[model samples]
Target: MSLFRREDLHSLAAPYALDALEPPERVRFEKHLKGCDRCAAEVRALSEDAVRLAWSAATPAPAALRDRVMAAVRTTPQDPAPQDTARAPARARATQLPPHVWGTQPPPRQRERRRIPLFVPFATATAAAALVVASLFAVQANRTQDELTAERDRSREIAHVLAAPDARASSGRDGRGRTIGVIASATEGSAVVTLGGYGDPSGGRVHQLWLMRPGAQPRSLGLFESDTPLVATGLGTSATSLAVTVEPAGGSPQPTTQPIVQLALKSVGFGE
Candidate 1:
């Protein structure tokens, strides 16, 4: 049961989703997945993303490009054989006698320079191509790992908010017909916000969350896109409500439009 720590097994989700794990690692992760719902969910999400990325990146090679390359190969002249440089000329050989026969040091034999094979250039090109591919793969893997790590952190924060001693949940629809759900915790001074049926906003506008108080100006909780959940913290004691408004692309210091939805954070009783 303790063969692999939870964190270690959790880190394998991306590799498992991509089918990049070795046989043993794959076996371990599969065993871990059965008992770990979070890991299983992550693997499923990553797998779907991987498939989309693969399909999007797959471009068919030009049909004529191969024929043109083959045609060029057929017409290209082969390189001439390299001359044998190891042998000395007959005259030079005749001038130098064996050290034993001449009783003198035979002039130092010319150092033989190694000749590079013609296939070496092709090998080098292949190696360069391989390096480029490897670098691209490394960048992609790092990006995926970063995304997964960020998601895990966000989930942890949301979990903390939901588990707060005095947390309360509320849900309502925005002006644009998107569902906004909020779980606010006075004890934890934070809230977890979730958007349902979220998509790209029209009119080049963005949705912004605000922290509201009775007499003070609304404080921005930052702009958001897509359906990703957001965790808002640092509500302090003065904050009384959470509101979402549609604003310009970069967002406004104050809400330019009316709130699509609002969740009251009055003590422990949160309501739409």
Candidate 2:
């Protein structure tokens, strides 16, 4: 006989073997297996293996844990008194008080009383919600200030790499003897890198720029789209140099090829 015509049953076999199937699926699978001898045998073997694995992983629970759990379970539950049943008689008595007080007054013209407005619980809840939302926004504003400080530090590092004199110049002829592009204008926080007249690399390879700071490793700025100008981001304060290299379709942790462009940045007024 065919092993369980239901595709869902076959999908449930592994979970059933592991005892992870929910109640409905487990019952249905068991019914299906009664007529399918091959599936039944396979499931039996898998179940045994699962039991063995669980037994190997089993460890004794702490002795006090079970006692504490049972103590909590044995506690009696308390029910609250119903509000309407408790308040109905009190409301009736309060209404009677007004009538008795009116009888004791000297005259309607001489006795004057003002009714106080009742408080609305919903209005109080709405005001509380508004206060909570305002507090959350205030916290977010403070977090943004901290993020801006970190971004400024990154910008300073990128500026340092662009100022190096020994950095590889982006000028020269390509393999085809045509003029290759040159990267120019290196500075702290921002730099003007060049993409030249040569054709872009093939096979999904793209150029990537990096900011290498003194005592710190290089960090990726972004991918350099072929035929587009080079720009960098996240330059930290006191960054000493810049490098550009060929990377995979996405880019890698380190430069995979020689840097096509390089620039050195100066440290002057970096902290400011």
Candidate 3:
């Protein structure tokens, strides 16, 4: 004689009406419903749709026809329950709850969050390292370029001096006061001298170039053999006159013989 609640109707009547119950459960529900008027009414209401569902499923119709038939049917409205009634103002409920009560606790430790794979930091580090390396290489390449430029300039200066018209003029008096063997193309500098067309000196002694300045002592340039027309030796930059003298096998601080060759350079402004 108890009335069946909508909540309990699904369990008590749905299985029997849908034919999903076992034979024993079906028999038990049928027996209980015989004296139960509330359950019988619930079953009758549900049976109307249950019979229609079974009939439609058993008979297959054309797809277009089925769609037309289904379009004519309307769904039934479901009754709300106690829980549904309370859920009417979910936003209000949320606002009433404390911030801590929700799952809004401070984030987990950094180590735990990093468990998921990511490559942002690693990619950034790689890019930065590449940039640094590129900058370093660029600096080194510039330095090498500067050095090469300087060397090229030095070589060009040497070539220019060698090509000058006055570079080959050499004049001097021998020990006998004879204006002996004229040499041409002589280039002189503070530390070195170069002469052309001067034959080699005889014996073990080598030819040496000296510079006689106004008041300073004669400085020894380097010793040089004269077999080749070209001769290069170290001399002082303060010399006013360029002289070549025969010296001992190595060389001497002073000229041992009268200058076999001499060239007085005209007054010219030389710049460093």
Candidate 4:
């Protein structure tokens, strides 16, 4: 019933005991172990196994060494007066405390000597996670830049085609006699259009473009936004007209709502 396999859960015990598992995954496993006796037992056994290895590998000290250390410890006198501690003693300078304890004396210089070895694995994993996040943001930024570049190029191309020698344009009126423009390259079938100030679509609907030949079914081009100049290509050589209609967001195979505007292209020699 769990999302991950039971074997996968069992395999995490060693890493979990060593504090190597990442959080959230580690937290989830801990929660699961509360109910799963088998997994809990396996983690305990693995932890004890590590302790057993430490015990087995330890070397025994000589028998007389303990008595000698005790005698030396007894002869060393303890400091009783705190006010006489202004002098730096040679014995204090020579003493070396284990690294795990906080040193009572200041270091000769203030600086990082080295990183702690225990944190290396976690630090590496955190750095890797940060790098992966940065890469994803970089990719998204690049894609957005590319899209803007392409849009600028497209606007420039539309302007060039409109200014070309062989290009022509036409206009058509809606039921209210308001006009929309269609401009195209007479030879290449490239065109730009205006939506003729049609109102926005209702919810769950969109505006669609079509290429129509006289007395024939319209071919769907794609979707468009209102009142903006639409740039299109691949208009059939026989298409003498174009239309805009409302449809669902994905656009229909055929016009589903009544056309809001129609442009007669024959007069402009579009797709001829």
Q: TM per model? A: 0.43, 0.30, 0.30, 0.42
Which consecutive 10 residues in model 4 have the weakest lDDT in total? 93-102
Query: Where does model 4 exceed 4 Å of error?
Result: 1-147, 175-178, 214-216
Q: Best by TM-score, which number?
A: 1
Candidates ranked by TM-score, best first?
Answer: 1, 4, 2, 3
State the lDDT of candidate 3 residue by residue for 99-119, as single tens digits.
222222222222312211222
Global lDDT of each model?
0.60, 0.47, 0.43, 0.57
Candidate 3: segments with Cα more than 4 A from true spot: 1-160, 163-198, 227-238, 267-272
Could you tally the backbone clashes for each prediction?
A: 0, 25, 8, 0
lDDT of 4 at 57: 78
Q: Please give the ranking of all candidate structures by lDDT, highest first, separated by commas.
A: 1, 4, 2, 3
The parts of candidate 2 lying over 4 Å away from their true place are 1-188, 267-272
Give the winner by lDDT: 2 or 3.
2
RMSD of each: 31.0, 32.5, 47.4, 32.3
Better model by TM-score, 1 or 4? 1
Clashing pairs in 4: none
| lDDT tens digits, residue span 1-272, model 2 | 53446776767666777768666666667656554545555665566677789799889999899999889878944322122222222322222122212232212221111100111122443323222211111112123545545423432332333334422234443342223232223333444344443335678898787877777767886776543344454455566666677889889887778877655544232222
Best by lDDT: 1
lDDT at residue 11 of model 3 (Cα atoms)? 65
76-139 per-residue lDDT for model 4 (tens digits): 7543211111211211211121111112223233222121221233334333322221111111
Better of 2 and 4 by lDDT: 4
- Which of 1 and 3 is ahead in TM-score? 1
User: What's model 4's overall lDDT?
Assistant: 0.57
